[model samples]
Target: MSVTKKVILITGGSSGIGKAVGIYLSQKGYIVYGTTRNVANYSNFIHFPLLTLDVTKTDTIKKAVNDLIAKEGRIDVLVNNAGVGITGPVEEIPDNEICNHFETNYFGAIKVMKGVLPQMRKQKTGLIINVTSIAGYMGLPFRGVYSASKAALEVTTEAIRMEVMSFGIKVANLAPGDFATNIAGGRYHAPVIEGSDYQKNYQMSLDLMDAHVDDGGDPKEVGIIIEKIIQTPNPRIHYKVGAFMQKFSVFLKRILPDKTYEKLLLNHYKL
Candidate 1:
């Protein structure tokens, strides 16, 4: 292996879309470094290095960035893919739960980005891709907190893109629709909830989540699209990738009036 191949590091690469992205990028001749909390249990893949990293820890981010720099000399791309989801009414979710959600999904990405930005600035060429969600665009019932976190990520990426454009650093957002990822299965909930308060709303949220699993797109397909975006001469600010129907939803939201859009969402949720 070359001392330094087209290097890229991805967080939360243990499974689902992150794992698929690692595999696809490695197959395409890019040296891929994936970070996850568990390094012992993993599939064997050629030319892909799995590192142990806890995104919420600043120390872990610093060490991981330094290790990559020492080994590869230059980091080319950093994909902020680590995140968690919480589903419930805003009032029902404890304040601490909201903070924890942002800790992993928003601030964790910031920590990694802060550590790597200095190195990229020194080199004057790099790409930072933040994995946001379609919910970033429009809020969903029972998903207000998750949507807020992703929306924050999107806005942060836009600001970073502007600030780094002149320095040859690119920042882009990937707003994916529902996909077959562990996002639903691996979600964390507030311990405060005991299934009594807001039971009806909570039940509706659970039903919607189940429906998403049934209708989600394949992670491998989204992985392929990420590869294409990385290879493009100039990547867009945001890439919306998923089934054609999801694209149609974006179109509908754009064309429909505010009341009409609200009605559509209400109908979908049977509210």
Candidate 2:
């Protein structure tokens, strides 16, 4: 691969937004490297490259970085897109459940960042786009774990952006709203089953959560926005991607008082 061509490494690129972005970027002349847990059952419009990686595994991350460097000579962009959500009340969530969420969503991104930062600094030109979510901006009840993980990622992105500017390495985050993806199926299920003390409320919350997941917009829209951001000369620090929910959430938090906003959310969720 030519070093002059844009080389991008995307985690969780096997399907959904990541895969869609890979197809689009490949068509646009980027040498895209995508990572997935399952490299066997793959089908796509393009035949770029697929690397096997379980984001929680540090050795896998190191191997991917080393392999990419050896083959491409340099990486121009790294998209930290591999993440999983775990939704439940803080009280009801088990210690292991919380750790699992952090393992993939928070630390997985950090691991990839750490592995790539040295190379980016050495090259003095690179871009890191973290696939965070609108949940990063606000903490929604029952989805505390997911929101907190994304929130941490957003903060890390901001801090790194400030620190890496002199190196000409840009760090930007895409905070997408609800999108049609398998993320819900991929989310960690809290170990606390039914009939426990928190069961009634948790069950109610689960039902409400189901409603929101069903209301998701298309993942293709998010994919197109990501492509645009990548192709832009200078991307913003953070962008909210999706339909009116993106704007409405920010407005609700900024304009409405806390109690009022809570009530509105409760009414919307039918809680």
Candidate 3:
């Protein structure tokens, strides 16, 4: 390995968008280190080196960063791509599950960011790309918690960008609308109560969400977008990847009245 090659660390690279991005970047000549909770299970499949890391655990995150720094000397880019989805009506969703959702989707990203910042600051040049979701901009039906978690991440990314700019460390949020992945399988759903009013609607909304993901954009496209961002001299703070409507929806939400936007969302989800 060339010492001059940039070292990139991406979390949750065992599958889906993360894996695609990791493989793509590695192929582009960057030294990529993708992290997963269980390296043993995915060691054979992952193309790049896999580091054992559970972003939800601070100790594990720190250890992963240290391990990478020890071998690579410096990390040039850190992509916070590990996340989970949870679906349910707010009233019916358990508090603990919501907490877990935020722990992985929001706080876990922050923990990894913190772990990598020290090294980035020492180097005085680095990039942090957080993989959020378009749902962050507009809360989707039944997927309220997941939307909220990503929303929180988007806001945090903004603040971190301003704070780290002086250090020559750039931060950006890549809000992908929908990409075909196994995320549907890992998503947490609220249990339907026998007589709960939301039971029927909840199921409908969950199905709609799953269908969108099933017919979503390709994960390789997202990987290409990430690669472009990496190659750019200075990337924007927010990048949206998906179909035209998905990206336009964010613009529409910005200009449309509150009720009008809500109505559009309701109609789209068939709620």
Candidate 4:
């Protein structure tokens, strides 16, 4: 019997890492369906079909998944790549803004997962790759909210991996560090009050964040990693992709003393 080509669904595919993955996977012969909030605007730009999806909206998430399944009959892989970043001092960050960050970065992913799980459960085979960040592992100085949001997703991904293993559904967290993308343009800056204690430090940290992204690793590298993961029958649970120093930081966080790790992080960020 000939193996059927897998149907893959990727969220936030209008640009950045998600767009690269969609283009690469579609070129590799898989039926790739990418989701974007403004499909009308992005439809002409992307190579593959673009589904209208706003991850924070449950109705849109459902419609996007249903539309893909109605046409393709199955969604073999789901990449939860949709997320937003919020930056500033934790104390000054508004509650609603923090909620918004979680809504898009964490809860939005959960909504998409719920939308696709039933079909994968019925088919008894599937793969879920959550595109998280190295910041998820360690909270950055100004990007605390963004880090916390990804960290929440990382923990949730672990739980889902165990829960779905019995149903032949494999789950993995893809942690990337500082990729060249338009993420800075989309990031929300917390309101900084005049004379606030964290003003100078926050500005310095924010500038460093932007510089890291500007000089970051190529996002195509991440796309290549996603393609490989899609082809693997039994993939590992966690994959960290990025520069050697970033990957090593994760390892160091695990082994170093709390104070020692804090010093290392401080030195790296020039804090």
Q: What is the C-alpha lDDT of each candidate?
A: 0.83, 0.83, 0.90, 0.89
Query: How big is the positional error of residue 96 in model 2, measured in Å on the Cα after superposition?
Result: 1.0
lDDT of 1 by residue, 1-271 (tens): 2423668999998787888888878777788999987677665644378887888898888988899999989888888898888888787788888899999999999898998999999998888999998888888888889989999999999999999888889889998888877777788654435567767667776878768866798887766777777777689998888777676777888899989998988888777
lDDT of 4 by residue, 204-223 (tens): 88888899899998898887
C-alpha-based local distance difference test score of model 2: 0.83
Candidate 3 off by > 4 Å: 1-4
Best-fitting candidate, scored by lDDT: 3
lDDT of 3: 0.90
Per-candidate count of clashing residue pairs (backbone under 3 Å): 0, 0, 0, 0
TM-score of 3: 0.96
Q: Cα lDDT for residue 2, model 1?
A: 44
lDDT of 3 by residue, 30-131 (tens): 899999998899747748999999989999998999999999799998989999888889988889998998889999999999999999999998999999
C-alpha RMSD of each candidate structure in angstroms = 2.6, 2.6, 1.6, 1.4
How far does residue 260 in candidate 1 sit from its true spot (Å)?
A: 1.2
List, residue by residue over 77-137, the lDDT tens digit for candidate 2. 9989998878777887888889888989999899989888889999998899999988787
